[model samples]
Structures are given as structure tokens and as C-alpha cells.
Target: MSIEIEMETTTMKIYDTEGFPNPARVRIALAEKGATNDVDFVAVDVMGGEHRTDAFKAKNPDAVVPCLELADGSHISQCTAITEYIDGHFEGPSLTGETPKERAQVSMMNLRAENGLLNAVGAYFHHATPGLGPDLETYQCAEWGNKQREVAGQTMSYLNEVLADNAYLAGNKFSMADITAFAGLAFADFAKVEIPQSLSNLNAWRAKVAARPSIAG
Candidate 1:
């Protein structure tokens, strides 16, 4: 896709690593909003410690991938913040939410998926497994990592329970919460965290989300 671009405007810039989980979230949001071609993408050499550099930190204190730079040169980091910008700026179905209740619900579910699943899996990968190798993973806490792995599994089960009644996270809409949870499951798969065979609702939800044009295409 194509999103109609305003005249004489500089395309916004996105600094990210392709195929990485968090970056994929923003990419999906862009695709969903039909704004994939509206911005310029700048690849960050994360494995080379590019994100940790002082220059990169100037753009984003967190030094994370999927950072968004506005046409005027202001920056927004963190996938959630970046997605919020995309959702509000671009014309499409709202990812965060459209109303007060919807927004609050989406935010709550997103955090659940982020903290309990995605971040939990991340903790396991970075702290327990040989994540990003020794160069980037300077500190490791195997015990804590192992504990988070259990949390990830438990979150998966919780999501399954939620999915039992709704089509997506935060209710019938495929909001930002769904995106975060989807990415979390993908991360879990990459980290070799076993998703139990019994969570049929979660598995079905995953299959549906995966088939969306933004992801399948």
C-alpha cells in the first residue's frame, strides 16, 4: 500500500531492525493503515551495538528499534507509543481504540500481553537463553529468566481464557492489544517456549491474526 501523501512534506522516518519482534508491530500497524509507503525506513544495525551508541540514544533514550521520527524531526520510541502515533495520524481502523472505554480496555490488555507474555518471554530469552549472544547480553540471570518463562506460559493460558468469549484481545476488535499478543506468541515460538496444545482459543486466535493481509502478505 499506498496512503495519499500530503504535498511538499518530508516522509516520516522509522529506525528499526527488520524481522525483529517489536519492529514487526509497527510494520503491521503501518500496513493495516495502508501507510506502508508513506514513510522512509532506516535500518538499525542492532547486532553491531548501533542502538547503544550516543548518537542513537540522542534519537531515543531507550535506544530501541522501531523508533519514529516526525517530519519536523521529533522522535517517538517504544512500540506502543509509535503505534499510537500511527493509529492517530494514519487513516484506518483504530488499533489502540476509538472511544474512552475501548482505549482503556485496549491499553489494559496490551499491557497484560506486553508485561506478562511478550516481556516475560523476552526476559527468558535475554536472561536464561543465549539471547543476542554475549556481546549484547552482558548480564544474565538464569533463575529469574526461568521464572519468567513460567509467567509466559501462564499468560498464554490467561489469553486463552480471554479468547474463549471474544474474537480478539480487548473485545471483538483486532486492536493494538491483539498485535502485541500476537508478537508475544511469535517471540515465544522463537525462544522455544512451549505453547500448550490445550489452549485452543489462543491457537485459533493466532491463526486468524496470522492470516490477515498485514501479516500474511
Candidate 2:
């Protein structure tokens, strides 16, 4: 199905990092929507502490990646929000969902994966393990981080089971939920977490999603 929206043609700017999962999620969504070419990619130096600078904070108070700056001077932060905007405003296959029910299901699944899995992995990396850089001496959340990693791993196992009977998280059709799942799972690889072979269905689905031109690009 085709969607039509009467919006002016203008380049959207995306602030991203090279290996960051959150930004990659938005990139893949844009690729799925055929909106990549229309976007101006701006690399953010996460290691250089650019995100915490006053300039970056002005764009996103949270100082997170995958921030989308629309031509209308509106800035969008968070992968889910940016993906939904692209899916809603552009004319093409809908990434969020077509019907209200489908939309709700996809949104719910996406949130579950994010909160249960993604956040867990992030906690593991940021608090439990001194990832990217050494933990700041002032950081006092180490204990919680270790606990979060265990929870994240358990959630991943649960998600693998959930994907066993379904071709996609929401249904057979690809949606933003898939994007979030792929991003979260892929990031786990960096932290030396491997998907168990028992989750064959998830592995198969991930392979298919990764094969998309958007993902390859």
C-alpha cells in the first residue's frame, strides 16, 4: 500500500555514531522507507564527549544519539520516535503499522524489547562493565549495572522464545519492532553476548532482516 503526505521536500539531518545501535536503528528505518538519500548524515563523536557539550545538549537534553533534525526546525530524539515520524510522513510501506490494532501490537512489542532487552544491555555496558572507556570514579551505580545485565540476558532468552512461532515480532510483515530487535541484539554481540543456538527462529529472522539493503548499507 502507498501513503501520501503533503510535506515539502527538505533534507533531514541525523546525528549518529558509527557503531552505535540506537543510531543504526534509525538509519535502517530510513533505509526501509527509502528516505536515506533525502537525509544528511552527521556523525557525532561519542568518545570525544561531543554529546555532553552544550551545543549537543541544546539539540537533545538527554544527549542521546539518532537525533533527527527536521527542516522545519523541529528536533526528534529517540529511535522509536524518529522511525515513527518517517513511517507516518512518507509515502510507502508503513513501518509502524497499517491498522490501529497492528499499530498497538507493534508498539507494545517494540517497548517490551526495548525495556526488557535493550535497556538491560545498556545497563550492563554502562554501569556493570566499563565499556568504551573506564568508569568514572564518581560513578556509583556499579552494583545495579551487574544486576541489569543478568536481567537483560534472561529477557533475551525470553524474546528468543517469543520469536519462535512468529516470522516477525508483530506478525509476518516487517515493522519498526524488527528494527529495534535487530539493533538491540546486534549490540549485544559487542559485549560478547551470543544468541544461543536454541533460538533458531530468531537467528533465521535476524539473518533475513540483516540482508535488507538498508541494513547492509
Candidate 3:
């Protein structure tokens, strides 16, 4: 199903670090909208503290990657907002949702995947593990991180239960929720969080989402 009209275009740019989970979310969203080629990808020196510099902070106060720069010089940060922009600006299947109820569902599931899986794994990585080394990881909280690791495991089981009834995280239709959950699982693997082998439905769903052209290629 086609979405919004392709607007009067310009060289939109995305500042990100390739291969990172959050960046991958925006990248997949672009591919889904068929606007991957249209946007200019500007690499960020995240490891060297480029993302923390004053100029970068001006663009994104949060100092995170995958920030979108519009033709009018406005900036949009966070994967959710960026994906929403991409979904509405380009013509393709709706990523957010086609209706209000569906939109709410997508948003709800996306948050669960993000907080329970993605960010949970991230906390463990940056806190419990030697994430970016001492230069970047200025703070350490092994206890909190270890607790979040448990949260991640519990969330995976909950997701498995949800998947037992629905083909996707939100429902039958693929939406932003699926994308968030997919990226979350990738982060989980990177963080060395054990994915329960018994979660057959989640594993099956992961394989299916991984096969999509936006991800497979």
C-alpha cells in the first residue's frame, strides 16, 4: 500500500555510524520507503568523540547518531521520529501505521521492544561490559547492568508469548514495532545476551523479518 506523495526533494542527509543497531533502524526504514538512494549518508566519528563535540550537539543535543537533516535546515533525532518522517515523506507501505488504533499499537510494541530488549541490552553492554573503553564509558554500574540483563531475558520470553498469537509484534501487518524488535535482537546478540532456544515463535519471526529485502540485502 502506497503512503504519502514523494515531496519536492532535496539532498536529505543522515549523520550516523554504520553497523550500529540504532543507525540500522533508520537505514532499514529508508530502504522500506525506497528512499535509501535519495538521502545522503554522512558518517559520524562516534568513537573519536565527534558526536560529543559542540557542533554535533547543536544538531542533536542528545549526542546520538542517526539524526536527520531536512531541506529546511531542521533536525530530527531519535529513530522513532526519523522513521516517522521517512514514512510520511516518501511513498510506500506505512511504517508507523495506516490508522490511529494501529499507530498506537505499533508505538506501544515498539516501546516494549526498545526498553525491554534494545536499551536493556545496551545498559548491560555499556555498564557491565567494557563497552567503549574508559575513554567513552566514564561511568560503570555492573550491578544495574546485570539487572538489566535479567530484564532483557524476561522481555524475550514475553515477546515469545506475544508472537505465539500474532505473526508480528504489533499484529498481522509489519510496522515500526517489528523493526524495533528486529534491531533489539541484533543488539542482544552483540551484548552476548542468551536468547532462549525455547522461544520458537520469536526465532521464526526473526528469520522471516531478516529475509525481507530491506534487511537481507
Q: Best-fitting candidate, measured by lDDT? A: 1
Candidate 1's residue-wise lDDT over 32-123, tens digit each? 99999999999999999999999999999997898999998899999999999999999989999989999999999999999999999999
Stretches > 4 Å off in candidate 1 = 1-9
User: Sort by TM-score, best first: what order?
Assistant: 1, 3, 2
| Full ranking by lDDT | 1, 3, 2
lDDT values, one for every candidate: 0.95, 0.83, 0.94
Q: TM-score, each model?
A: 0.95, 0.90, 0.95
Query: Which ranges of candidate 3 are over 4 A from the true structure?
Result: 1-9
Local accuracy of candidate 2 as per-residue lDDT tens digits, 1-217: 9999898768889999967989888888888888878899999988888888899999999887879998987899988899999998777889899999999989998998888777778877787676767523236387987787777778777777778877889887889988888888887888766667777777888898889888976
After TM-score superposition, what is the CA distance of residue 193 in candidate 1 from its true location, in Å?
Answer: 0.4
Worst 10 residues of 3 by lDDT: 2-11
User: What digit string (tens of lDDT, one per residue) describes model 3 on residues 81-112?
Assistant: 99999999999999898989999999999999
Q: Which scores higher on lDDT, 2 or 3?
A: 3
Cα RMSD of predicted structure 1: 4.5
lDDT of candidate 3 at residue 19, scale 0 to 100: 90
Clashes of 2: 0
Candidate 2, clashing residue pairs?
none
